[model samples]
Target: MARIYTPAQFGGYAAIVSCAAVIASVSSLRLDSAIPVVPADDVSAISRLALILPVIVAPLALGAVALLPEEINQLKSSFADGAWLAIAIVAIMQGVTAVTNSLCTRRGDFVLAAFVKVVQPAAFAGIAWLLVRDLSVALATSWIVALLVGTRAFRGLGLVSGWRDSIDACRRAWRYPVFFAPVSLLDTLTQALPLLAIVSIFGTAGGGNYSQVQRLIGAPLMLVGLAVGQVFLKHAGDLIRASTPLTPLFLRVFRNLVILACLTVVVIVFVGDWALAVFLGHGWRTDTMFLILVILPVVFRTIVSPMSSVFLLYGRIGLVALWQVSYFVVTALAVFLGRSGASLDYLLATLVCSEFMMYLTYFLLAYFLVRRVDRYQLGLK
Candidate 1:
């Protein structure tokens, strides 16, 4: 799909998709994280809380966009047509999917959770192949349909229970979303804001290249991180509930991730350019320097990914949220400093620095949190 489409077209699609993702993330209120931490009895309620927000917020957001069509157009000229409608649909779908995925995770039904993860990109690739001529619509429609299908799969699992339980559940878990929603929003913004800035300053083509590089380097690391993180979250939550000492578990996971990160860095440093040329094709090929620049941040992310669950496990959402805000601020500042031209070197450098800072902060925070947990368990405090 990336190869078939020009950078401008791909960039436009990427911008809209990023915007929809930001909206969805905000509407979700981070209840997905809460699902695993909250009591099993409150799972139904949290799921309901997840559903209610999107239902209420998506429409209001769509209404705002509809009313301020000119403002939206100014923000992204690609959204000049009825593209905003597609964005709205995607946002709503994403919100619903987040809730459903969380419910599946809480229920320990990783099969369903994993299926939901696979369905979106698989559907997008298939749909994009068929609609090769119109990449924007293809991408939007793919997400809309995939998310809807994934959400529907949870129906048979009895996630909602009933209208009465839905209301009661929301009441019980109200605090989780209220506290975590802003944290989730800031985290989502940390990701989306940089892409949005790149698109705004460098146009869709620059955004396209940026998005592609992220897809190439970030995707592999994210896949491994997500799988490990999910298992870590589930296991850690179980241990906490069982009153088990988490110091050993935390140390084991940390050591394993460090080993994995070392191996990943070595592989990318040696063969990254060849791998990129072979997999992404000659058109996507770049000099080894650029490839190195791209992989550096991904390396940081690789190390940070496994430890991300620690923040959620230890009730340090505020610290994580503050770090996300700092990330966005630094990224935006870097973009402003380099806005003179759309230099890939400049953008990559900025991104690499920002990602390193954010990941490093996370590592330090996780270390302190783990030490605190260890001390408490040993009666040192």
Candidate 2:
């Protein structure tokens, strides 16, 4: 991607991706989340809701984006001329793929789930590697086509057999639409803010640089975290439904994540620049400063993000929502203060500090919730 497309082009690609992610977060109304928690008989209804909701919701998300002309333009720049619809299509695809992914996760089909994650990026990079021209448009269309990535997970499932059941499922899972969707959306927004802020402050090229920084130093480890999150959500959710203690499971995850984080930081600190130069270019390589503030928060986020499902399992939506609101406010304020000072270092520093602190608090809160559940479970035993 780096060799074929310039930083500016890559930034546009990243921007479009971030926008699609925001739309996808709420597109299924987060009904995919309920698949593991709900009764077996009800899964089909939820699957139907997952398929239909994205159609209804993705347009609304795109329409709302249309109201923000600049945001629309950022997305537009990523596609070929006369291909503006690619944005909405890709967003809908992302939402649909998310639900299918949830389906795969629910069934312990981790191999397929992992394969689905690889196909898009591999396809995008392969296409870009073949044709350097119209790089952004090619990438956009690749993602648009990737909506089919997880369709295998839907084969035995009934997505449209009973419309009435879908409605009933929607009614039953009203809390997900009302509460979980917004929290999930807020989480996506939080993840995307730094790139957006950098682009706003710097330019698309800077956004590209920041995006690659994440791809290089953060993404691989975070991919591991995400894969772990799927397993954690499944198993921890099982613990909840079975009325089993979860603190031990939570702590084991926490400990392993910490060790993995340390290993990631060590590797990145030692050979990060080499990997950056290899993947992007020597010109885009980082220095010591990047090793400290930038990498710290990346590792911090890895530890906290996966375990967050524990909160949802325990019905602690209020606390999760509060943490999300606080994270956005604090991070946005950092953006505001740094933009005012006109110092990228200050912005990055404040951003990293704020995120590290926020993630730590999130981990502690999740731990406390699980421990409380542990006490109750022991008393029952």
Candidate 3:
């Protein structure tokens, strides 16, 4: 796709997808997070809540994006020629896919959840291969189709019915958005800003390169992290409900993730350059390889993936919110500093530093909180 399309065109596609991701994250209203924690009887209602909220929120989000000035969109490498319609479609689909996937995971249907994760990239790759002549349409169509397919897969799961129950579910869990929505918005912004900054500072070509490397490297991490995190959260919730000690399970998960992360880093260090050349074509081999190397240190912190669910289990939303805000500030500052006469390498280095700092902060905070909670519970016991 990178070879088929100009960097600006690819960057435009990336910007649209990134914007859709942010919108979807906001419209989800964090109802998905509550799916596993909420009572079994309320699961269907919560699923309905998830479906209803996005229908109400996505159009407003689309309107807001449509209202942005053309020049601003151009600077961000976004599509300004009515492509917002495609973006709107993708955003709504993404929100529905997220909720349905969460419903599957909460139902202990890990196979379905994992299949949903696999569908997007597989569909995108297949479509891009088939439509090599038109990368933009291929990319947009891939997302729309993949999300629609994934969402529809949940049809018999009883997630999308019962309007009255959905409204009641919304009323019961209204506070969910209070803590999570803002944090989710901030987190999405934090993730998307770096790509936008790359476009603004280094032009669309830079943004394209950055986005490619992000997809290449981040995809595996996302798949593994999400699968493990879902299972961990489900088990953690069960154990918490049973009043069992969580420290042992947390430690075991942490250890396994550490082993996996270490193995991944070792593989990347040795074969990463070769893999990039073989898989992504020769054009991506150099800069992408170097960027991968630069960010390898940050990959170590991926061991803390399960800690997120730990926070949710303990209802430490305040801590999670604080960490997210702090991370956004740190990442924004890094981007600002990188804009000051820095090369792409330097900018990437700053990103690595920012990611390392954020993950380190999270690990420390989660560690302390987990220990504190364990102690309190032990005292009560």
Candidate 4:
């Protein structure tokens, strides 16, 4: 898009997408998180709840987006025509996609999940190129991902029917909306924070640059981490069912992620500028220090975000939510400190340190949660 649209336009697209994403996080009422923990026998009910809630709740989430200040819709108006409508549609579509993606992963359909991860983005880019003057990145990507994944996300979900199943589904997983909804909401907001912060503090051009890095670098790594997480969530259930020790499994996953994390940090620190120059071209600023400060936290995030599911697996949703709230506050504090008569690099630096610590706090919590669950399951407690 750099070759076709200005940085400001790309940033506008990102802003709208990020706004919708926060709503999308809870559009399913976070029922999808129940998939991994719910018994295989009750999988149908859980899937039903996960899928159906989005339909009922998506409009509400979109309504929340629709209430966003009118100023948001004014961005790049000629290119981003119908920006508010785009947010509403993307919010609903992405919510459905998130639910279905989890459903597919529950079925061990990682291939399709991985395929959608890659292909949906590719499709969006292609669609955007064709619709360049229209600036369709946000809308195009949401449509493509929803269409590609919803087909299989609904597989085997037709087993039950009628209002009976719907009510039964609600009865079965009422804990999700009550418990994990806030966690998902806080998490998506935290994930979207830096981009929104950049846009707000540093302006649209900075947001554009940051979103590109995320799309090209941070998101792919996170998706791979999430793919691994899906497998972890699935297998974590099996180990629990069989009364197996989770510590060994947890450690093995942690070690592997550390290796991947190290490799990514090294690549970004050494050749980040060169890579950005090649991929995004010289038109965009690709400062080395800025990249390090902004991206370092993402490297640590890749290691922990996927594996943090241990808390949920152990029925510690409340604990995880508490941690997420703390994480968001400290991160926002970092941004606030950085913005108060401090340079952008400083904002990113303090943000990095604070977030790195928060991620460590989460990783340690997950580690101990596994040990506790293992002891209880194996009768060591």
Candidate 5:
């Protein structure tokens, strides 16, 4: 076997990222969420922020890349050089992480996978520091690094064979994600709109406060969700690829999520307030509000994220898009109506209600997809 990536290597990387994130978080002074407010404040900053959306859309907008039939090969050549250069310059740490995780998954090296998970936060911490100074660079760099690293690591672990293999794997992976991009964009808009709305209706401080609440609480929830999704993706991908039954697997994942949701509810009910108070101080410790507005959506979203892997396995991209569209519409309308009251409580309540409804829709859709897969696998249809 090629030299294994020791846990220490993973731990070291994680530490660096963690440190960076800590610095970034502090530097942000809880202003990361205030980003959405930029366009509303200064026209120049708004233009800068607007420019980023296209950049964000570029990589995933491969369909546009494909449309240049006469220049297909040229586009590929150009994109190859540009993408690699961008990733190298901006996302080296994240790239390392992605590659490592892919390798671990392919090798069935759960130990390495576990290690990779821990290291990512350390990298994030590092990226976080950069973010404090420049939000755009930090955001772009973090994602590029993470994706490239995952891509490269998959090759190292023999999940993929080489650069071309890695590209193909990403292409396949991107298929479903890309299909859902429109609705995904909508969801992004809805999720991010609150901060924007607050800034428009209120100001930077208002946007910043709500944004901070989302970030502080959202971070841990996302981390746990990340670990869960990664583990599930690896396992489920292997099973589906092997042609093993997936209904049982789907049900199992659902059960675990339900358990997690229950536990989350308990925590939110009890220690959530104390934890928030300790971490964010009294002004930010609206855990009750956060629990209602943020935590539930996070939990619901986490549950769907893993299960979405199954849809990818089945190539049900359109269905996934449909679900996200539903979610976006609901969330947007809720936010819009909530803003009318001009109170934080009203906004928080709207967010919570929208997410709860969205989660129900996600669950139902997920159930339908799984059932369809079962019939297809059984030759019942």
Candidate 6:
């Protein structure tokens, strides 16, 4: 019998995403706080290299990494020499850590995914302590260890499939990037634009603060959203392919997401600063209002988050690209122009504004697309 979704599964998924969020948030706290202290410019450079890497490196690295077949030796070797080799190494390891997280997530095992993700930051901290004196090595080792731990986690979960086969599956999933790339770019810009903008004003420290907020709110959003979104996407795809209707499923998930977002906002408003103080320390923590504002986009995201699944379900890459680009452009411009003053409040407000724009834009587009699809199916188009 197929495994039924249960409270245990929910526990597992939540545990996984929460854990991942903790690790991510804590690590950001450390990195943001650590960057200013490194004495040597070269070490700082190396550390900064580690930091600036994924902006350019992640996708290219992901592409190369995903293209390989499931040979362990081959995958390892390829990862060693790939572009942004260091970042690639980190990505590989992090990918492993997230494997079980992703699997459980796809299986509607939210708790498990959350539980698995929590280990990531702790693992990094442990490694960072070991190499704390060498900033570059510490930075590199943090990710490396995280990946090692991730691999072990995947192994423990029995999700460690052959690299060759994993790559093969990814190869088939290649069509996704056509749509995923642009959306991903827009996403990176939305989250990372503040850092870029900060270069003109307060330099790295300002960028670091912005990055921290982005990491704090954005990372959790992705993790939590990913957990639910994966399950929803898979179900929606299956239903679409089976010629079964999907509106009920979409609506139910959408409502649940909205309810979740409301609760999240309340928590962020009430305890956000206290939580940040405990987790990120006072040095890296910002205003509660700023955090609250940063979280607004998540509400919009909850509504339109599943739209890409619709795009992928119908293989509507062109429409997805167009809709996503429109959202991206509008949001980027709004955020860029809005970055005035050094206050986290202004920064977050801008970020939230951009997110809201994208949310509304994507939601409307997805709604219409779904409606059009449904009408066409009923011979009413």
**C-alpha lDDT of all candidate models, in order:** 0.72, 0.78, 0.74, 0.75, 0.51, 0.51
- The alpha-carbon deviation from the true structure for residue 2 of candidate 4, after best TM-score superposition, in angstroms, is 2.3
Q: Residue 349 error for model 1, in Å? A: 0.8
Residue lDDT tens for model 1, 73-104: 45546554756777787888888887776766
Q: Could you say which candidate leads in lDDT?
A: 2
Q: How close is candidate 2 to the true structure, as a TM-score?
A: 0.93
TM-score of 3: 0.90
Best of the two (3, 5) by TM-score:
3
Candidate 6 per-residue lDDT, tens place, 1-381, comes to: 001222222222222222222223222112221222222222222232223333444445445535666552122221222223344445434433433343343345656555546665555446545544322233345655555443432333223334453334334444433445555445544544444444334444444454555556666766667667767765776677778766677778777877877887888888888877676553453677767775676567755675456765676767767766777677667656676545646766776767776677666666677777777777886
Q: Give the worst 10-residue stretch by lDDT in candidate 5.
A: 28-37
CA RMSD of all predictions: 2.8, 2.4, 2.6, 2.7, 14.4, 14.8
- Candidate 4 is scored at a TM of 0.91
Counted clashes in each candidate structure: 1, 0, 0, 0, 21, 30
Question: How does residue 2 of candidate 1 score in lDDT?
Answer: 57
What residue runs in model 2 are displaced by over 4 Å at the alpha carbon? 69-84
TM-scores for every predicted model = 0.88, 0.93, 0.90, 0.91, 0.62, 0.63
Better of 1 and 6 by lDDT: 1
Q: In angstroms, give how far residue 297 of model 6 lies from its true place.
A: 2.9
Q: Write the per-residue lDDT of candidate 3 for residues 1-381, one digit (tens) a residue.
A: 655666666666777778778888988798977887887777777777776677779879878876788676555334556567767777877787888778777778888778777777787777877755555556567766666766654565465457787778777877678898888889788888888787777777777766766577766776677788888888888888887777788888888888887777677778776776677674553443465744453464457755677887788888889999998999899988878755877777787788887887787887777677777788953
Q: What are the per-residue Cα lDDT tens digits for candidate 5 across 1-381?
A: 001222222222222233223222212111112221222223222222222233343333333434566433232322212332333333233323433453454455766566545554455556646344333344445555454444433332332223454344334334323454454446545555555455545544455455554555666666666677667776777676676777787788878877877787787778877876676544443557555565676777776666666665566667767777777778778878998885767876887788878777777777787787778888988
Query: Which residue runs of candidate 6 sit more than 4 Å off their true CA positions?
Result: 1-88, 91-116, 129-183, 214-218, 278-281, 340-344, 378-381
State how far residue 63 of model 1 sits from its true place (Å): 4.4
